[model samples]
Target: MPMKPAPDAPLCFHTLIHRLEKLKLNYLEIPAAVVQQLGGTFNIRLQCSVNGAEAFACGLVALGEGRGYITLSSKRMKPQGLQLGQQVAVRLWADTSEFGMEVPEELAELLRQDEEGDRRFRLLPPGKQRYIIYHVSGVKSSQKRLDRALLLINNLKQLPPGKEDFRAMLGLPPREAL
Candidate 1:
């Protein structure tokens, strides 16, 4: 069964939306006081809910001063009828899952089919592994996700430290202009 957001998951709050300048992506600011309350472990995973929707594994961004934020993908927002600048309740818990998020069946099967890919994938940091899993999960089509997973795995043999190279090799969009 997919993990559900726990009422006991360390923290819960109502946050206002904020847009990343230039990128135009919308996100929810996780307050610094809350971050400090969570012991400043910004790299940690959380099972998060925006409003009352089903929860998904979320990672907190830890960049500059205003960096404690969660990306609010349209996929995860539409069903709940969310909008920019709206205050919504968010529940967050420490994620204890093996992959940080639930493993997409497509990616899992592809990994199982290629031992070398599996080895290389396991060698990546847990966060990177989850990023791959989450990236594959972003698409609406199972076929597309499977296709991306194949390209990602095959390229993992010599892929570099940046996501853009992987995105280019996978024929996907660049995440940032940088």
Candidate 2:
């Protein structure tokens, strides 16, 4: 059986009508009152569904003065025929998945088979772990996913604990060099 949401979980959004705003970027404003009702903070991860589209993992980004917004990337908007200034139905739910986002099968299986890799991955901050997971899971090809998972785990293990550098893990030059 699946576990139920905790009593205090900010599991729903009250707003159903919101205009997609574009000021150098596209997003929908989350009312301050709604934010207050959903735990009064902007730090929680969420699963958002727009206009009944499939829910996608996201977070409420602070936009000052107690207001927040979830950005809609063009990649996300285009496929759904989302247009600027259009009204949308946005629903939000508390993200309860481990690691805050869905872990891809390739990465999950690799971590399960490699003890040291899993240990190193767990030692990183949650945000860093999400970054690595996103990188590995963003592609469309299974071979590419496995390749990225292998690359990340191998590079992660090469670094000492508590001293991992994302740039180095991706084989990029030190940030200071750029």
Candidate 3:
């Protein structure tokens, strides 16, 4: 079930920012349970009424533990006006499914034959799987994707779910590392 925002949750601006920073994540996962309520994958724009004005933002709905969190970059204009405990109404939706790559036949078969690989593959939501797929597919005119796929598969085979950072596991440097 989706965790509802409390009616009187205090607007703690610093706390909210702290939490966001603590996550140390570039993306936030939207729980699968709430995906439907937010219009599944159709709606893209979210409106938050703030300070007597409407603040609009673009976001991606990602899969979380049990429910989805509507994720917006802190760099967005809407985020600028947000305080910790404001009662802003958010209207959101998933916008696109074009970010990931198709599972290659050879890789698919390899995954199928390896029990651990199969388990990891099954555990990932379609969006995450698509993310990996698309990432692997994005390297054009080189064998980068193939190399990435091999590294990803090996990492998934070694790391448990909560510990995996698909980016780091693929041996990519952190944003700051670049």
On TM-score, the leading prediction is 2
Position 164, candidate 2: lDDT: 87
Candidate 1 segments exceeding 4 Å error: 1-8, 63-67, 140-144, 158-164, 167-178
Between prediction 1 and prediction 3, which has the larger TM-score? 1
What TM-score against the true fold does each predicted structure earn? 0.73, 0.84, 0.39
Error of model 2, residue 111, in angstroms: 0.7
As for lDDT, the candidate ahead, 2 or 3, is 2
lDDT of 3 by residue, 30-94 (tens): 44444554545522333332333444333444444434444444454244465444344343322
> What would you estimate as the lDDT of candidate 3?
0.50
Q: Which segments of model 3 are wrong by more than 4 Å? A: 1-101, 141-143, 172-178
Q: In every candidate, how many clashes are there?
A: 0, 0, 14
Shift in Å, residue 120, candidate 1: 0.9
Error of 2 at 45 (Å): 0.6
Model 1: per-residue Cα lDDT over 1-178, one tens digit each: 2233443755788898778878777888998766766667567677787787788887888756634888888767778788888999987887788888898899999888889889888878786787789888989999999987888888776566443254554655667855
**Candidate lDDT values, in order:** 0.77, 0.80, 0.50
lDDT of 2 by residue, 1-178 (tens): 2233353453455342344435666776788766766666876787888878888888787877888888778888889897777777777777888888999999999999999999999999988999999999899998999999999889999988888888877877788999
